[model samples]
Target: MPSKGVRVFTYIAVAGCSIELSVPKQTVVRNELNTFWNGDLEVDARNIDSLFNKKGRFSFKVLSNGRLVTEQWIDVNAITGNASGGTMDTIASTPSVFSPNNDNIIVTYGFYEAGQGHDVLPNQHQCYIAVAPNYANWQGKLAPPGSAQEGKPFNRLVLPSAHDVGMNSMQSSDSVLKKVGGAIATSLVGSHEAVAQITDSVSGPAISLVAPNIIFSLAITQKDSLDAMLQIGARYFEFRPAHCHKTILAAQALPDRLYFQHSAIPGMAYDQFLSDAVAFLLAHPAEIIVVQLRWDGVPAECARPSDQEQREYLDAALKQAQGQIVAGGLDDLRSSTIAQLRRNKKRLIMLVSVDSLSTYTDAGNATLNGDSIVAAFPKVLTAANERGKAFINIQCQATAANITEAVVYSVLDAGTTTSCIMATKAICDSKTLPWCRDNVLRTCDNNVLVVMMNDFIDGATADVAVQLSKQRLEQ
Candidate 1:
């Protein structure tokens, strides 16, 4: 089915059985992987049994017009099992498996036995092979010294960022209840739920108890740790830190604590986030990370830490990362290049809200005020088209209906809540990435600086950022 004079060959070996498949090249799209095969590959019972019985490894090689493109071997255990058929989205896989030599060619295979009643192949084995962009160590590859990107302003480059970077941890109902008192927690839940649902005494008590936890579930944006995010090419991170109530801290016998929160539900400790990030920076000397800290607003029932207290906490936490922190005004940071920053061993940019400006200054770190940045959803891109100002355009595709489904399903079956959220996030991310590529990045004109993604930021978002950054550099 390929065009004239173009041919693609896939040789797959499972256990002792080997099959060679030849596919002709159709139109190849940039930054989009081509799914060449989706049907079943007949495998004998003995080979199929060997696939599951032993820890067999499958190897595949892709060739285009008699020239080898990419080859990889994967363990049988690594292939995830899904009754609904495996994903064809190549970006969902780990970045390390991607072919470093060729970004356009990737081969993924999913094995299914004959007895399994899967819809795709009820009585035969199923394998899927797709071609996608390779994005291993993309940040280092894009901004090395003397590269075209080296001369560009740091803010002007298209960077991948994670929205609410600290919300990766799971929050329990007990933890949420303790952070904000029962009365306030109930109020927060009531505001988000239907009046009728909250009034029912039987379901009401259970719902009230799990309300804050459910809210936190919906608000969780990233699933990967800070170091994993950096390795996946996330250069920017947004953290919303809120002061913990002294009463709660004292009750728990904890010292002055600051926790990253989505609204009022707390996730990871602020100090822990700093330690992980600093450790990553020290290991990867050429990498750069921009951190923006803002106060996640809380209800009037909650008390905020005094400015002096916040300053002391921030100063102590930032001191751990002092060696990597970039010490310069906004103007200076905007003019510096990736190579220039790497040369000075100043790879971290700390941006604080206006109220926290004094905190940054008192810590002896040159920082940018919140005014220097604009955080907007995709709908506000037109209004955020101002030049010389940094913009974090969040690529969020989850709809109200999707969120409602997650909440209702979570309430019905608490066990399925995490999987439901993950599935919803996958669907949303699948849509968001393509939309970002066609609409946001394609129409970008130097106004957008960072493209942020929600709900488990992955290498796919980083791939888009790399593509856009490379395009800009070539231009």
Candidate 2:
């Protein structure tokens, strides 16, 4: 591994692995997009980013563990070697070509384009390699949801309502995945405005590239350094349509840098860390805070409770929060919880984002049913109707009501779309199911929401908070 500068070709002979270096004259270096660079190695400094007229050629044959490896080459001038660095070799007055460093490092060489003559393409030409430290042994798993298969995971999300009625809705609306003509892929870097047009046409869960690899590498060690890279293609490159890393930072009023960990329990003093976070948020009331919670206690084999038991637990939690409460046990929530939630509901409204009637969890938990879930949703609406308190369903089921795009992303991101659909479909299709009557998809009043519970963890919570904060500020 070398820095992004010029270096002398060297050979380190490993017993089973070996590499050879040489310069062959009249070689062409190009970029991924078939752009030309340094057609002829003419040494000139004017086109620093372009290939120079460096005459001479360099090539290598690498062998790993007695296996014939791929070969690479570099065309250079009668090179006077300046200090060479990581993946580059500098010629005093010629185009510099890089020889292969490792068998694991893959370099795809192509032509770098010049307006009329050969030029050096600094960005795409040199160091255009994705170096996976242990990629030799690494295997790619199927992406959940977004892919073209079932059971095999894909990178896209799924919603029950979306499957049931969303297609019909989409039939009349524009599609975000627009088809491009064969003539365009080569000639244009599709207009940024045209990309915006597609994004604007479709309104749903938007994806964004979450974090930077360079920053992560500097912060965490080798063990977790590759975690983010593995997530690159599987995850969406960005979040919301208009949102970028900068816009998010500005809204949060956070420092320029932030860090995350998979867990903090057992390794760190949990209670003290939580207390410090709480204190900081309390101290800086204006600053939006993000927190991660992990459980460290020994796992308990608690049996899944009945609807009555679940409702009882929920009611207690709501009461502790000093809000209106509800308890719907295997029936309409209005019959079980709405009346209770309606008491003084205006100030501290209580809403739950539980899977009411799901027959399965996203991971294929087989106990949830869709009709049962729908039965529970109306309690919030009932409470909102009786008292002015807002009772948002906050469930991600599109067929239910008030669902948000964040929930859509979560189900897709988690690779649980099939399970979610199976669970909801059981209820929606069941003739005996109470809420399933004529209810393949339920239309929702704007205020009654089906918010995505998973959105909160993936930074989608910040978007909701920002929207709410903006509305409140305007008011």
Candidate 3:
């Protein structure tokens, strides 16, 4: 965090997300960053009013040996141009020049030159920074700009959703396992296991290959709760509903209602998380959230059930989730327009996946399910490009053999930051997304949405979801 250029949000000003900056003994920090944020450093800590005063594009550059190595951009207005949803910390003010208190900026920066190879990595001390919401405290309802995006057809907005919003924890205490004939062998863990299972994605009951404690550190996508994600500007959540609490033999059983999960491990009850979203919407009124759901993680014994059995299994799960979500009073956006939805103060929009379930779609209460996300995204991009508007899912992360967190993470770790950024830019390019491509992509009169996973830097990665959302919302 640059002392002068960085805009500290929480009042009584703390450094923006504890960063580690490597300063040289002879280097003059002031002279270097003097040109970073325009020409002047106008930051205020004593005055909460001006805490969010800077409105525009801001970038952070790492200068090592007088050369730029890595850079970060901060977009403050991604929430609102007026900064309605921000507040200062509750602590008293001790202002300074940089920040009134001038808590020294800590940044983890690179020390190598541009061309220097894999000689150095990010930092030995691995920590992620997520700024807590200030001025913007919890109202009854959380606000995501998606709610106020009126007149935009479904899927035609820049909405980035979390891959597995509730994997915030991985507890066998909450396991939803079953003895499916083809569940990935708990022994066959890793990318290979993930591959073997996807060969029969719908056959086996979802199982957790690894144990509880290990998975938590490996798979959990959220560091905070749903409300936290909303404050960070995330409008979309991707969930997998399961007959949770399925323990290993000693007489296993399923929970009454569907629960949240990555695959086998569970975290947060489905109804409770939805209830929180409902409360937030009731309070904010203007903000809405879009939830994409699928009936997932059913474990069955070695036998593959008949087609009828599979349909029954899926329909049952879908109905269960529908009942719970309906109980919570969220709107079924399948038939409502942005206008109709807002008029009713029904802000939670849901997209349920029921492969080939014509019975449900024909009933007209909701829409059909989604396809392989990887497959679904391309069509969405093509459509967004053709119509100059889009409702798309960006499936960028690679999941291994049996959908375990380890394999998923292995793939992501293998990707370089440069590759991830380039891949994001390619899909978001005007050639695909419905945005005009200049130096930076911008949405036009038509609507545009770019939902990503794995590398959903904008509000998907738990570490900096809030910060990323601020930058991605505008793109």
User: lDDT values of the candidates?
Assistant: 0.46, 0.23, 0.34
Error of 2 at 449 (Å): 13
Candidate 3: C-alpha lDDT = 0.34
Best by TM-score: 1
Looking at model 1, residue 244 earns an lDDT score of 48
In terms of lDDT, the poorest run of 10 residues in model 3 is: 88-97
| Lowest lDDT 10-residue stretch of candidate 2 | 233-242
In model 2, which regions exceed 4 Å deviation?
1-269, 287-452, 472-475
lDDT of 2: 0.23
Clashes of each: 1, 70, 46
Which regions of candidate 1 fall more than 4 Å away from where they truly are?
Answer: 1-137, 171-190, 194-205, 208-216, 245-247, 253-255, 301-314, 317-324, 327-329, 354-379, 397-406, 414-420
Task: Count backbone overlaps in model 3.
Answer: 46
Per-residue accuracy of model 2 over 77-188 as CA lDDT, tens digit each: 3323111222223111111122244444322111111111111112111211111122111111111122222121110111111111101111111111122211221111
Tell me the tens digit of each residue's lDDT in model 1 across 305-327: 56676567556655776655543
Candidate ordering by lDDT (highest first): 1, 3, 2
User: Over the stretch 198-312, how does candidate 3's per-residue lDDT look in tens digits?
Assistant: 3344332333432322243334444345664555455667666554433333235434455565444445666666667766665565655777665444333212234454345
- Candidate 1 pairs with clashing backbones: 33-131
What C-alpha root-mean-square deviation, in Å, does candidate 3 show against the real structure?
15.3
